[model samples]
Target: MGYGFAWHPVLLNSLLLLAAALLFNRLAGRRYPHSQPAAPAPTPSERVGVSRADLHAALAERGEVVDISEDDLEDILQRAEERSHQRRFGALRCADFMVSEVLSVSAAASSDKALALLRDHRFDALPVTSSDGRLLGEISLRELLAAAGMHPAPLVGQLMDTCPHTSRPDDPIERLIHPFADRGVAHSMVVDGEGRLLGLVAQGDLIAALFREQLERPA
Candidate 1:
């Protein structure tokens, strides 16, 4: 009358319960699988496809925009495009566009000699360099004219702008744009690490380089 080996039934029931649980878990997983959220769309700043029409439509959708006219907006866009172009071509160094065969007057040269060089070259200014080709200053037509009535014409060193604007050959060409525009800098002497004259960059040169870049840019 003892419970004669009832372990078999208990083991069978345990196995059945485990199987049922596993089957139910598999079914539940099939019915409700894990999912990932969809990615967000690219914003205007992230995508290059945002056009002027898109901007106008966006402004219209907001309703009753004020102050800025369409022309002003177009001008702004043009400026932005120009800035983008600059950034894209920022790798262009001063040495790339500078005129290597520059006509510089020696600092020891007389005022008359400096003026002659400027007039002969049809240049507004000329860089004054030392005998060893180091940049000392710049001489302009105005300086010579200012000393016109002097009993003795001053030397180029005396009349030159000692603190003239200068740029390193490795510098980005874009760095000179502001100086050319704001300070009326006609030429920037491109020097080396030891301040030796390497080349010259005129406003026209910069403008031509940038214009050429624009023309060669892909449509």
Candidate 2:
């Protein structure tokens, strides 16, 4: 009985610490909400049977049934058509869909120029580059807040968290998703084996793909 009384304060302190940690995690998560963990995505094999291209072709066949079987084809296509065009599960493919048009800011370019581009372009991120476009660092709205001289004229070169994660045109997409799980980046620059920028794989792009697939499926 004496021992139990002596341990009361220690147990209470441990419970208090646990509650503090929970509160701290919630507050920190609000500041960096994108870092929150996501549900596991489905694999290519799961999505392979009804490819987007094939579905689009079905929907394009307006009133004419060329040489195809209408009943059988329409039945197969209806399942995908009724589903919400919103994305569900999937991985990203660099070559099949990543955007190749990557706009960049120059390190020597003034902060005003960077801010202007951020406003003008619809993109959520931009890579920084040399006069010749050397793929320096990148800038996003998160980094833009410091451009008011609140800090150094934060050079795009300095803001790049790290070199972009790139993949070959032929690299299996499942492998690519693994690196994205822990990175600070929300997009990956798709590149060739020679490291030439080809396109970008923004998180939105993957979500868009699923929507596209649904749209193309037959009703």
Candidate 3:
């Protein structure tokens, strides 16, 4: 009877330990999933082995490709060919598209005075210059508005974009397109041989020229 009693306690203890171990294993697994092995890192050589079908699959996973029919493609190409024929490469000049008259403010002009000009003309930006028409800088409407609330006379020289990018009049139409396309500048100053302001080339000028080429195409 004593041996049987001792054996009963030992068996019960063994059962309790087994139950506790199972519970611990379940809890540990749920709490620390990251303790498992990490996913494999991609190899650089993988890209070299990537096929065109794989590339298509990856892009497709991101978004669906918009399909255009063969007929549509042909029509677009026909229109493009016609525009190429219509472009008057020799006749086009900088003076034809440039805005000759521009409202340029002196570098010494106060922010308040500049604000007044913008209010009257509804212009968002103005070019800053010296009295001699020497280009100094450019200021935007947003900068002017911010200064207006402060009631301060910020000098145009201090606020204007001094190192403004520019282009030459004698340059080809590609000059205008490249800047607008690459740098996101809305307008470019057409400078003379001596860096004098000859005219202004805007996004509109390029658009008009491109459209004119298309419209004047031989039917």
Candidate 4:
């Protein structure tokens, strides 16, 4: 009986070890499966077709174009997006559009002289500057005439606006949009870092520039 009991204990231990070995082998096979790693998900290709799709998606998001065909709209959006990127990076500065040959008059100049400058250039307003080219203010024909009607003095200083809007030559053209909208402002003076007159930006110039950009874009 003692021999039989000892044999039973030995058999039970051997069975337990066998079970553990089988379980470990099953787990290892699952972890390091025989199959090869899934062919890396096919990488997307870059092509003009993808670009066209992106362009269409952008136009659809705008929700403003209902009359144009898909092809035409894609072309327009692509060109517009290029220009937008240029403007965003400050490629077009105020100096690029400003008229550097500004026709201005001295604040000390007589109202008659100022009017003559305006008449010669057919300008509605002229920047009034010190003899040293420092911008003092702005004078308009309407203000000149109004001043003449109200007082005898014909000096431009008396007729000029003391607080005229000013901008820098390096400024982005977009900076003028709000000012242009708030006032029916047709022009703004471009000044140097020292507040000296550098050039002028007219609404007509901006409009012309936009037209030119559109024309020059790739069709």
Candidate 5:
């Protein structure tokens, strides 16, 4: 006698459900195919403050890896930032950072007095002004030393720098950078149109001001 195979009702229903689920998945995939996730937004340099890690990541993305240490790269970036700030604020005027109410010596003051003032105040140089507040020149430790061996101690007017570099209040601070660097000038007299000393600008003052501006810069 031949036997007939019969499927159980539960088993038959489970097979049908499995086939339907496979079919539905295939059709749904065709209709709404999966896509690569959207590329992440680029990291902004200003927002992240341009760290060495960010630079390395950027270089890796561009396939332009360079053989340099992270410390050296960071130093280079810092110098570039300083130069950028210098160029941006080059137009800043001398008056902006100059020290007002400057301490000055009288032109008629003796060299000894000027030297004493410089030593007492720990100043590198002092402006020499006339009785009427007109800038005559400047006196520095160099001049005072030179005048020391003279037969009669010279007056500040005689020993002072008669043709010192001077800057107008409105002059750009950039105008002084090269001169200060090239000539090793420590200070510049900020004078009015009539050559009356208004204030003084020093290398340190410029540096401090630039640093402050950098710190306060907008992100």
Candidate 6:
């Protein structure tokens, strides 16, 4: 009887210990849950051996692409920007920026007179006009020199550029972009409706005007 009684107490003690262990395990599991497994690393083919289609797909992930390549799209954007600049320039008139105090020469002026006038004003070219102030042509230092080489006392009209580029006061400054900006035409004659000289628009003047306008723009 005594041995059976002692075995009962020991067995009861063992059962209590087992129960406490089970409760502790349940509490521990609730306190710190197991972490999720990490994502698998990309394979060699995905990492290094990407195909051309895959390259395009990656680039197009943030945008759509139709028939144009990336370079073609960039070119189209650049041309659009250029057109926008031209439009902005078109808003300004030629008379507003042309040099009003234009130094000109008579069509019958001598080379010595032309040279003196150019040296006095430090001008690249001078508009050659008729006595009635009509636009005749333009004479530059180059023309004067060429004429002087041919004759000792050369006339201004002989070597002048008869087909000089001319513009109207009301015309947009954008008109100069082609002649001055693209074709490298340095000087232009601003004439009135009656072909009378009003002013002169030179490349330097246009550039200065554009720079001033840019500086005065709102930040």
Best by TM-score: 1
| CA lDDT, candidate 1, residue 86 | 71
Candidate 2 shows a clash count of 2
Model 3: residues with Cα > 4 Å off, grouped in runs: 1-91
| Candidate 4 residue lDDT tens string, 17-36 | 87777788797775422467
lDDT of 1 by residue, 81-197 (tens): 656657776566789899999888887888987887777888888888888999999888999878766767788888899988899987777777657765578888889989999
lDDT of 2 by residue, 1-219 (tens): 678765688788888887787778777875322366785554343254454455457668765555656556645454443232223433335577687777777777666567778788766667776665455666777677565664456556656545666666665444443345434447777766545566777666655665676676678
Worst 10 residues of 4 by lDDT: 41-50
TM-score of each: 0.60, 0.48, 0.56, 0.57, 0.58, 0.58
What's the CA RMSD for each of the models? 22.9, 15.2, 14.4, 23.0, 23.6, 26.9
Instruction: Give the range where candidate 2 is weakest over 10 consecutive residues by summed lDDT.
Output: 82-91
**Residue lDDT tens for model 5, 52-148:** 5677788889896688877788668756764664677555788999999898999888888888888999988899998778899888898797777
lDDT of 6 at 114: 95
Off by over 4 Å in 5: 1-87, 149-151
Q: Single out the weakest 10-residue window by summed lDDT for candidate 5.
A: 1-10
Candidate 2: C-alpha RMSD after superposition: 15.2
Candidate 1 vs candidate 6: which has greater lDDT?
Answer: 1
Please, what are the lDDT tens digits per residue for candidate 3 over residues 68-102? 65456544544553344335443455566788788
lDDT of each: 0.78, 0.60, 0.68, 0.75, 0.78, 0.75
lDDT of 6 by residue, 130-198 (tens): 988998998888877666545568788776888889989887665565566545689788999899999
> Model 6 lDDT vs. the true structure?
0.75
- In model 6, which runs have C-alpha deviations exceeding 4 angstroms? 1-83, 86-90, 149-152
**Deviation of model 3 at 137, angstroms:** 1.5
